[model samples]
Target: MIVHSFPPIIDSGCRMLVLGSMPGAASLQAHRYYWNPRNYMWRILYALFGDGREPDEAYEERLAFALRSGVALWDTIASCERKGSLDSEIRQAIPNDIPGLLADYPNVRAIVCNGSKSLAELTKHFGDHPEVRSRELIRMPSTSPIPTRDYRGLEDRLEVWKKLLEL
Candidate 1:
């Protein structure tokens, strides 16, 4: 199946850009980023930036909160063929115009890749671009529900992701 990424949830004030590989099945079905309840992206963001409360259920509210927090969201892959939500399944990936976006939004000081795939794709496609090299590039653990030996729980992942607060 061919899946496409959403438009960037970005603004002029954004200082941080979070890039995922692409929207997964649940997110695509719901027309939102990290729509899967088990996904820790929202939870981690709220834990770090919110007032010690659960993230708002409304996607609009979440986007607003992220923007207000000086963060933006997007995907490394503009479109790809994938059998499932796993990044490993992706093929024929066409990258988004990351350099163009960065050129337009110069305020962004850091680029956070949500997982290995996102980082790999970004490096493959845009590593040499001046816009990308100018900013701090970060590779974060995937916020997907799937567990890994290193990041098997929210607390574990949250600890590593807390570095975003420092940026």
Candidate 2:
């Protein structure tokens, strides 16, 4: 059984919040989000940063970049039991304390869930609070490697993500 031992580290100054459904095994093992290889989040973010640098093992640096750019990171589910890293296997869903987090951080102007699953979970709990809903609700493709071919390539996805910076 996988446990969410800690809340996701988010920047208080973030104007945008990017949420994944849950961390993969790699991420859990690493004690960090988006730690899996072939997960395009790092690549996509690096493109947005305009350094043309590939994502190295330095996750703190990447996270720092996001924070510096006014973006926050987290997942919708606080915890779940899963037989595997597959998002579909997630059961006994427990919603994270998102509203509380948002209340604490005043700068978040938009929320972008990474996939449909996350959107469903958020909507189920929040019940169309436009203050949270109106902030951006884009249907971003998942960065997980388990499901294939759902996402645009790194560069293309980064183009879409760039809008967060504009907001």
- Predicted structure with the largest TM-score when compared to the true one: 1
Give the runs in model 1 whose Cα sits over 4 Å from its true position: none
Instruction: Show model 2 residue runs off by greater than 4 Å.
Output: 146-156
To one decimal, what is the Cα RMSD in angstroms of model 1 from the true structure?
Answer: 0.7
TM-score for each prediction?
0.98, 0.87
Every model: Cα RMSD to truth: 0.7, 2.2
- What is candidate 1's lDDT per residue for 18-74, written digit by digit as tens? 999999999998889999999999999999899668999788999999999899999
Which 10 consecutive residues of model 1 have the lowest summed lDDT? Answer: 50-59
Q: Evaluated with lDDT, which candidate comes out highest? A: 1
Query: lDDT (CA) for every model shown?
Result: 0.94, 0.75
Instruction: Write candidate 2's Cα lDDT for 132-155 as tens digits.
Output: 665667667766654446444665
Clashes of each: 0, 0
